[model samples]
Target: MAGTDAAPADSATTGPVDRAAWVALAGCLLGLFMQMLDTTIVNIALPDLTTDLRASTSEQLLVLSVYTLAFACTLLTAATLGGRLGRRRVFVTAILAFTVSSLLCGVSQGPVELIVFRGAQGVSAALMSAQTLALIAALFPKARHGLVFGIYGAVAGLAAMLGPVVGGVLVTSDVLGWGWRTIFFVNFPLGVIACGLAWRRLPQLREQPPPRLDLRGMALSTAGLFFLLYPLAVGREQGWPPRLWVMMGASAVLLVLFVVLERRLLARGGAPLLRMDLFGSRRFTVGLSLSLLFFSVFAAFFFTVSISAQFGLGYSPLRTGLLALPFAVGGVLGSVLSPGVVDRIGSARTLCAGALVLGAGLAWVGLTLQPISGTMSIPAVIAPLVVGGIGTGLFVAPLQTAILSDTSEANIGSASGCVPTVQQIGASIGLAVVSLFFFGQVATQAHSAVPATRAELVADLQNTAVEPLFRAPMADRFADCARNQLTSAHPDRPAPGCDGDPSAQSGMAADLIGKANGQLQEAGRAVAARSFVGAFQTTLWALAAMCAAIAVLTLALGSRPGPNKPE
Candidate 1:
């Protein structure tokens, strides 16, 4: 409706959005929302899951990494499969798979179960996401594609913003006594509705005749990506140059073999797994690199902000999610305006501006984080975050245009898959790198701050801690109890008195006071804030460096007016 007049000169032949087309778009949009939602929705619940599952920090990180890795690796194959078969068939199958996976994830009892289900969800997401752009292309005429894409951009940007909030709300609500399980469970109903809508509304475009599945290519690429990504994802947690390094080396070898296999496939006149020639186009190559960089930074934003709001500022998940609303508003504002900017200034200049603006926003955040207090002034955080959000919106859509502008229509699905696969991989890398950097920095800072031994530190913690130890078993055994009834764990279990006599009455009294005083003195408050803020600033600095580098590459991207501009 927004850009109806921009429809192709011949678009009227198919008429307007029409009952079927409109319905189909809505259905697809819902599916898209679900997939994108899973990407960020797990952030707020990570700490909760760590406690409930008795998971180590590294194990918790796996719950996030495996999903992205599976999603990224399968994307290219999924897109090609959709194009060779039918978008409708793939879409429907993916939705069902994703729904069942969500149910499985909700019921998971351990880290393995959760990781496996998350992988399943990622595979389904790959199938679903690849066809979205391709189907949208067929739904509208060429002239109207730009406007449709803008709508798509707005939907994606908005979904990402809402994910953390929705995750936060569900986690905070503890509905049906579900606790963190509610976050994954909420998707069950949403997924079912999406499936039903898609079945009824999506146009079953004449199914294309099936082509060869490129089995060899698929296997090689899948293995190669697994090798490359598995190490990257798990390395930071497992320690680099250890077992991760072995996997990293193996992945490099396999990726090299994959490249050789692709060459052979091309020589044999077969369709390669990835269109290797995509790199031949300067615009495609440059645009893709920038997209990866931009998303890498954007992904970091969600993780950092969520942690800062919850662990540092002591906000609940819902409140933290609410804090991110301005990001979505800014994102929408920037996305809507990007088309016009590209029309007038061209994609290159627009991207350059986005890069510089994003840098400035991150710089503002880095500098101001020092002064951020527990009172949590929404305006202070929102304004600069909004500026960064706007920068994100401005940079993404135009990059897509530049990448696809010269691609053959037949290969558009592959092109679309490339966009998201690169994004997910970049996101995985960003998270791993940032997490390692943060932990490394915190460990370093913590050690440097005091010469106390671990026992001494623990003793100091026992005597002067200020906050409740959420990690202790007593806290966990009673985790099912209501928050109001949640009593201090260690205090309930009496320790030896100062004179070495164990007595419940006097020991309990002294223990309670000590517990309160210790909780009050615990570095949970100061250390959490200092470590998080320090890591956040460092990560931002890294992102700024990445942004500037990508900006340089963006200049090499061919000059294009983008789809929205009149020829």
Candidate 2:
């Protein structure tokens, strides 16, 4: 029952490349651009989203995390569905579906509604993403694969780097007074254009017997991922309860079962959602491992930096988003130059060089950060960010080719689909771990700031007309209040009993009270800034270390496969 109408013989792989092929490729790339853009675009809008929706910390996390969780969970199943139902059919449908979901997300009245629509959007993205590489392969000859994938990689990298910039612009511009909603709404035109192009120009290849749907594999995979990812996403916010630990343990068991099921199904000559035999190649295994490690670090780096820049540095959304512009420029440059480098030193060395440069850039950014007041000098970090971006461009552009070098033509679709799956899973795990680490450090740093806060408060009270007896106690209260404010889950809200009123002398002069409050507020800002800067610096160091490890891992990948010979 899973099939599409047969197409003309020329529509097969041997078909000549023409304007239609290029147009179809553009359609596919547009989908890729939107999908990748959405991953990080929403991040810059989170502050506005939180204010507008009155969303809690957990709800905010869910709005961001669910899209990725849904996308990662559905990729394998969607890829198989594409093979069964017809790639062009499923792809065009998904583009329209994604557009509708984005519209729904833009119009949602509550966090819950937005979350639901985001999940829908992610599934549609998966449906479209799952078909992209396979469709590209079918469209172009093997000899042009590198060139085609380079263009693909550049679009993907550009979209990701530009996400914050685009979001910031839209949210700041507040087009039609939509504020953050414009981020989602902007997808409408792009999706419609892509759908139109794809429907008309995307070739319908000849239908083969459909592969059986791996229903059990899909269920097991989905359940296992949920159990694993859900706990990580919410564990810190919920205080790391025993239930989360139990869920993680259950996740391990479920995933083991999923693997077993996959292998057994493959042995029985059944279609497994993930082909177990892909792991048989050391090259493929190493490539996947590298993806997991690389993406884990990359995702966490962006999340931490964006939060610190906006929250800690008191930057406007536009300023925070513009901070990535240098990186984006660098990424594009690196991507553009990657193929030439690969030709000279091969893919492994190019990747190694890229990783080393990225690590150095991260370290530079960490060192450049200062705990002082006022805006951070963007110029100080521009060079480092650009270096890091270039490194990212260098690594990402060739990663697909390297990963699939050893894979057979028959398994290319399966292997390509798994790449994004691992990347998303890595991103999910990274965000969870970084959140836990960053927030813990924030709390610890806040606690450590108490002594300084108390001293500052005592000095300010010395200039006031208050009695000595009341001064020490008031200073202690102020210090404790500052600590509580910094450590709260919602730091923007006032802490309890922090009204800044002198407890002992309710009848104190109004001028004296105002002065004391002003001093204390200034001190609080200083303490908060220092704590965040310290935490952000440490997080950067950790990520830089991971990048170095990625560089080392690149050496383990097999030599880049030779160029394809003409059949």
Clash counts per candidate, in order, are: 12, 0
**Candidate 1 least-lDDT 10 residues:** 483-492
Model 2 TM-score, 2 decimals: 0.91
- lDDT (Cα, tens digit) per residue for candidate 2, span 1-567: 113233323432444677777888999999999999999999999989988988888889889888888888888888888777777888999999999999999999999999999999989999898888777766676656666777787788789889999999999999999999999999999999998778856655323677788899899888888888888778767888999999899989988998999999999988788888999887778878887887888888888878887767777889889988999999999999998888778888888898888899999998888754323568899999999999999988887767765665456657657888888888888888888788777777776666776787788888877777778876777777777877876454458867565453455544455657677677666776777877788888888898999999999885755453211
- Listed in order, each prediction's TM-score against the native is 0.82, 0.91
Residue 66 in candidate 1, Cα distance off native in Å: 2.1
Which candidate leads the pack in lDDT?
2
Candidate 1 residue 474 C-alpha distance from true site, Å: 25
lDDT of each: 0.69, 0.81
Which RMSD does model 2 reach against the true structure?
3.6
Local error of candidate 2 at residue 461 (angstroms) = 5.0
